[model samples]
Target: MTTVTKNKVTDLFLENAPSFGSFLSLREESKQIVNEKGLPAAKDEEYKFTSVSKKLEQVITDFSTAKPIAVSKDTIKDHLWAGFEGSYLVFNNGIFSKELSAFENSGFGVQMLSESNAIALGSIAKAEKDPFIALNTIYFEDGIQISIPRGKKVDSPILFLFFNQANEGQIISPRILIEVAENAEATFLEHSISLDEAVYFSNSVTEIKVGQNSHVHYSRLQNDGSKAIVVSNFETDIHRDATFTSTVVSLSGDLVRNNLSLRLQDSGCVGNMYGLYLLNGKTHVDNHTNVDHTKPHAESNELYKGILTDQSRGVFNGKIFVRQDAQKTNAFQQNNNILLSEDAIVNTKPQLEIWADDVKCSHGCTTGQLDEEALFYLQARGIDKMQAKGLLLYAFAGEVLEHINDESFRNYIDGLVQERLGSNF
Candidate 1:
């Protein structure tokens, strides 16, 4: 008989779990879940392609104490987007930094999670199902709740900047809850960065609720350093006549895994997702998305693209489910990849499970190198090989970048993408 021993990292998480919170019972329950399930191993179906737990074990030796290093305002200023006139909420090492954060009177309500009586904090994200989410629920130090009042349209965007400066190996979990009331609209940007080349594991969770007749646009940028490992879960519930759109741009990281789940709870709801991951070196990025349509007259669209060079790897698994009651549903999903090196690899799977016969659902995936004829045509011109390759790759990534709605944010992300592609044009 063989007896399995629990990983020390899990024990560290259990030992350092927060004891006080309004959601103490929920946190306790999550702690129990984590204790029983532990972290997902390579044998797990959902995480087979990416071994997140093993990778964490390699880099993180201790999680009992978080050593927070001071980051200057000049350092923060260097990362802020130029011409972005919105509110800035800074999180230093996964804890909300009130002194470093600045707010604009955008008419939205902002409250600390530890002090607010938010009933929907744990309603959208289910920790019982995912161990990473369970870890986040157990170890999150502090978070924020943003509420948009009913019938209000916010003009400026809200940027949540997370700067990690842990000297020793540590575990950082950042939690966020957003609520958009009926007939309201808002945009949010979540950006993650590492101030120094520190070894750390960041597990983050964000839950959003879109009320009836409301619209929400969310964008996430992950540009952590090469020594950082990150796992993030983004879950949202869309109500009747609501629209929700999310764009995730992953540029660099040691090991990054993104789980995005969208649930359409009522009729006439729409959900759209777009993702772009450009990787080099030995970095690994895995994106898993699930879109659930539970009612009639709902729609969903998803498109994810990847460009990998050197020895980097990419994985994408997207699933769409239409229940029996979800008649007249429309869902489409596609994942495309371009491998720029002989050693680069990508694994893509697009799935659709529809129980309703009246629904229109389809999914497809493609993985290949750049078009040789097009490259030859460009080389036939005055463009060199590297420049021509960069141009082609940039054009390949533009399909996903075009879906971003905000002009300023889109332009900033465009510049980042261009830099990654090494294309000056």
Candidate 2:
């Protein structure tokens, strides 16, 4: 038996090696917020469904710097985004790759931020106690800092490329910061992909702050290799009258978990979250989201759908919190899952903690197979059994995909869904 050490990096940092003095301040700050002794286990309320302790038992080599590699444009040709003609930031193996990236401007300036720029953005994410975040803060070599000037409406969408190519036992961390100034409107897409067959681990963090009356659309697509392991956290703060919408799709990974938290700090703000996951062949995927309505008249809506097949496992835990002073808050949450095989399993929980008297909050979750009646009805209309099943499965997921405002992006995802469903669809 092997003993698992928790927060090994933090422990090493605190022990006075101080070789990386540049990150000393950050390490100290993180130690103040996070529990440094015990690793988060399955018993922790927030990590009930996801546990990396077993995998962490293995010794992991700390990756602090990356060796620059030359990558041809043709290598990334198959990954070019569709209908996106705005700013682009590309990262390979957690290191920013300049040659493989493309950027377009329609008048307003869009550029990657230097180290000086990262200093200011780092100040905004100082309130959290996350180990993954701590590691990323100190070691992330380069991060894309996107600043949309006030009142500017970007006609096109910005694309962020997080491409990884590593073999067994390798670890990668990519960091990003996005700031939308007051009344500015923009969209961002974060895509993660891997081409190699490796049991690698990827730890990523993205911090976003939406200014007053700003509108931001953020999408995260995790389509890594089946042998990959990923853990990511996204933290966002919304201001008065601002709108923030996010959709997460998880399609591949040996063990994957996403932690999403939104702070509705100001009144008259709206937050929407949507997620979809398709798992098969012993994969394990979990999504845990928290929406906090801390001010009056704030609103939040969330819907997540999952399709699990073979012997795969899926988990969804969604929570909505309405503070006492958050009067007139309207929040709703729902989680639905479809299990295609008897060996497949899904664990879903929708939690609502409301402390406001005049708030409207509700949450519900259901896990089951496709409706037999609906499948039979479709098959009666000349559709074969497999086709009918595929049609019903696509329809089940279409509800969430419909929320995407970009027609081109939505179409691409539609095609991906069909591909995942195979000839049946």
Question: Of the candidates shown, which would achieve the greatest TM-score relative to the real structure?
Answer: 1
Off by over 4 Å in 2: 1-24, 31-35, 58-70, 81-84, 104-114, 119-128, 423-425
Q: Clashing residue pairs, candidate 2?
A: none
Q: lDDT per residue, candidate 1, 250-277, as tens digits?
A: 9888999999999999999999999999
Badly placed stretches (over 4 Å) of model 1 are: 1-8, 65-67, 423-425
lDDT of each: 0.88, 0.76
TM-score of 1: 0.96
Task: Kindly report the root-mean-square deviation of model 2 from the true structure over all alpha carbons.
Answer: 3.3
